[model samples]
Target: MELQQMRYVVAVAETANFTRAAERCHVVQSALSHQIARLERELGARLFDRTSRRVHLTPAGEAFLPAARQALEAAERARAEVAAAAGEIRGRLAIGAIPTVSSVDLPRLLVNYRTRYPRVHISLRSAISEEMIEQVKEGTLDVAVLGLPPAGRVVGLRGHELARGGLVAIVAPGHRLADAGEVALAELADEEFVDFPTGTGARVQSDDAFEAAGVRREVAFEVNAIEFMTRFVRHGLGVGMVPTAFADELAGVRVLRITDATARVEVLVWSRSRPSPPAAALLELFDIDPESYS
Candidate 1:
């Protein structure tokens, strides 16, 4: 029932180990377990099912977790809002981005944000566009930078375009199309490709382009990282399709323009609800009106 008890429960649920949760909460194991037991007794339900090897949330714990998180978030926001009104911005800012983000220099931007709001705590994570979008919607992420094919849309969320460009092809020096200035999708239909996993936003651009042009290509190498994809192309494992800026950075691969390539759109997205003070400040740095989204 108490906030401290809820904190212990949430931490235990996240770590799935009483000892680890106690360490994370800066308390002893016995104390955290005792508090959680008190909470469970007060609620007339057991929140967790503990075994000798592992711990997991019981049905009651699953129902209690979301409300506990909301309560904690609300308390933190209240404190942050009061601080902001007193001319000091203090809060947590959780940002998510695709690994291949290039429209903005994230490191530089975050440094500037830190300089401007020294009291705010910031966390950044890299994930595929779809996962980031879902995190933003779930309120786990305050903002995100994501890329999608031109035909893709950001449904159920608020976002604005940052940049749009077509993907370029890369081939090894010894490949048959290495000397080509430009090639169409059909020309590369028979060539094996090194690309991101099938449903990722990075792979969708090339996939849509091939489908639109009625070309079917084999993805011989599937990788999650752009650097790995480029490396595969450099070793003649397969051809790759990557952003122009990324392609220009590689040394051993020959970059080729795709005549029928689809464009990738980079977008900055956030929840449709009003943003936290820290998130609003970050959005303002981008010259975006946060109130518009609200």
Candidate 2:
């Protein structure tokens, strides 16, 4: 019946193991078990089926789980609201992004944040979209700036689009497609491609295009950085995608427009789970229109 009991039940349902749930709740297993037993007795129902090898939620547990989760979430939201009203927004905020995020103007954003919340610490890291999403889910990252695939599924995270534009093909000036202003997606199907690994935003855009056109290109090289990909394209290692601005910076390359590829704008993603005080305060700076997401 208590909030602590609700936490224990939810953790157990998620982990499917009493010991792991106890660990997650930062409580001894016996105490968690005792609370659950008391709750079951109060409700006059068995919440779980604990057999020889594994534990499974019983029918009653399944029905009660959603209500329990909602109650916990409501409680947390109340706490956050209280903290926000008191201006208690000071803590570390971990952020992750891919190399393509250079366009995000992070310096300006950080400066603004520092001016408002001088006590809050911020850390940024470069990672692929998948790794960033995982870190956010694990509570290691407060935010992630990524170029997810067009309409790609992002669960348990709220995202706000930063910028949206088409992706372009970059090639050495001497390449056959250099003089072309634009080309179909299938035209480069046979070319060797030097691109970011699978989880990157650029890779997602490229993969989605190829899959839609039913064309497959050979990825000759998978580079970890956008700078490396740009270098590889200049050396004729293969054609690759580059942002229009980035293409201009890379110089010497033919930045041909892509006709069939979809360019999903980069997005700032954060967990829907309760954020720390600093994370919540920083999120406010994004000026997000929650209704747009609705």
Candidate 3:
């Protein structure tokens, strides 16, 4: 079937209605229906089952959905490759990061990259670690910064370790431990905690740090947003785990290094493949080595 026909089929499959699908594809309903009918004739199988009131994918259509999506993606990628080979770095690059880094790191990095490559359009999306990884794999994101362990995963991508520093305890500026520069994780065993949401990179790191140090954290709050955690920590809700950069910036919060040697987190740069020149240029601005930032 022709690419146009496949596009029609995909649109119809997604919307499950001819009129809405046509609107999405910027075509008339009659034209879209005709294209799908032609495609079905060529394949000798009906792709969808439609009645007066309902429309749904047939078994064959369900099976073909993924393959059709891949074909479209491959076609788009081929066009992008040609555009890049022509020495024109002028396509949208979608980059994602976890919330903490997005706030602390990306603003400067993006500004510098834009200055250097003004022709290259850039879009930044922020999410927790799990969401970012999925977006990368699904091609919604060109690259992402996440906190997955460096094992038991495919390696078509490259990862750069940017910064390595231990987790620190953060509290309101006037709290008892606020004046301390170094504190053990276990020392706050009875303290209330503001924690990262479940299934996030920061949460995972926080859990690992406590487990390694043989400390059981009593979490009074488990939140999905870093901003909430920051606000709560500032109001003396409890201690929280935050990136070193974030801890340094929050005006009314005090950060104390974890005395336990095992409590550490590393900032990483990751991409599904070797990044485009624009992304690579942006990544270069980060100080992966702790000594450089220090």
Candidate 4:
């Protein structure tokens, strides 16, 4: 049967009244009845039992209604998919981002994207790099904004480098490090350090930073949330290392520059191979000047 027939059938099934369903479907009552009758005839079945005062589904109609509803939904979804592919870019885009990007970049990017494409529905997920990659591969995430290099080996995806920013040390205001303009990596050898748990994107960056400085870290506490780690640093729990942007925003902690060696963390935008047009459209908004990162 035609998609319109399916729509008419579903409307009638929901309202269980001819005039009400007709009004809801924005069709004249007589036209709605004719379409339903045409659908029933095409299917070679009596779909409804109607009297002057009441209308109800017959056994065949009861069986047909759900299938009809499903068909209509599928048709609508197919239409939307085609529309999006045609550069309409007016559908749901699922975005997964690591904690650091979620703090600032994502909000700004989403705001800009919404202003440009108001009809598009955007869903945001906060995840670490590895998890975000997994979601993209499994088709759960349309795109991901994560720290570079990817946590896992690159497989079945493409990555776009967005920006790069330096790491900063977060220390308690009263701590010795608070007085320093910049501290050497060797100075952290004896200090208690707060950092992300192993296997996290931040942890990978933290490890690389120390390795680049030819120093081994002395991590006293390993936690997931940067905010929590900063808190730990603020109360003299340990010195914390995080993105300069992250450290700069914390009120109770002072950020100290790391000296001797320059370190950088790259922000990356990634998506699975052959992403949907909606995903591609949303990804465009994430583009920023690489120079802006530092």
Candidate closest to the true structure, highest TM-score: 1
Q: Per-residue alpha-carbon lDDT of model 2 for 1-294, expressed as tens digits?
A: 899998999899999999999999899999999999999999999999997678889999999987997787567556756766787655567889888774568889999998998867789998888889888886668888987766876787888877777778998888999999998889998899998886566787888888888998899899988788878888898999866656567766788988887876788888886566777677788886443553
In order, what lDDT does every prediction score? 0.91, 0.82, 0.72, 0.74
Off by over 4 Å in 3: 5-59, 102-104, 111-121, 134-140, 148-156, 179-181, 261-294
Residues forming the 10-long window of minimal summed lDDT in candidate 2: 285-294
Model 1 pairs in collision: none
Q: TM-score of each candidate?
A: 0.96, 0.67, 0.73, 0.66
Stretch of 10 with least lDDT, candidate 3? 285-294
lDDT tens string, model 3, 31-135? 989988988888889999999887899999998787887787567556656666887554556888776662245677778778877877788887886776666
- Tens digits of lDDT, candidate 1, 158-224: 9989999888999999999999989988899889999999899998888888989998999998899
**Of the pair 1 and 3, which is ahead by lDDT?**
1
- Compute the lDDT of residue 86 as modeled in candidate 3: 85
Provide the lDDT at 144 for model 1.
98
lDDT of 4 by residue, 73-185 (tens): 45644665798767776666778877776234667777888888787788898777888888777666767777753233456667666566677888899998788978888
Ranking by TM-score: 1, 3, 2, 4
**What's the true lDDT of residue 18 in model 3?**
87
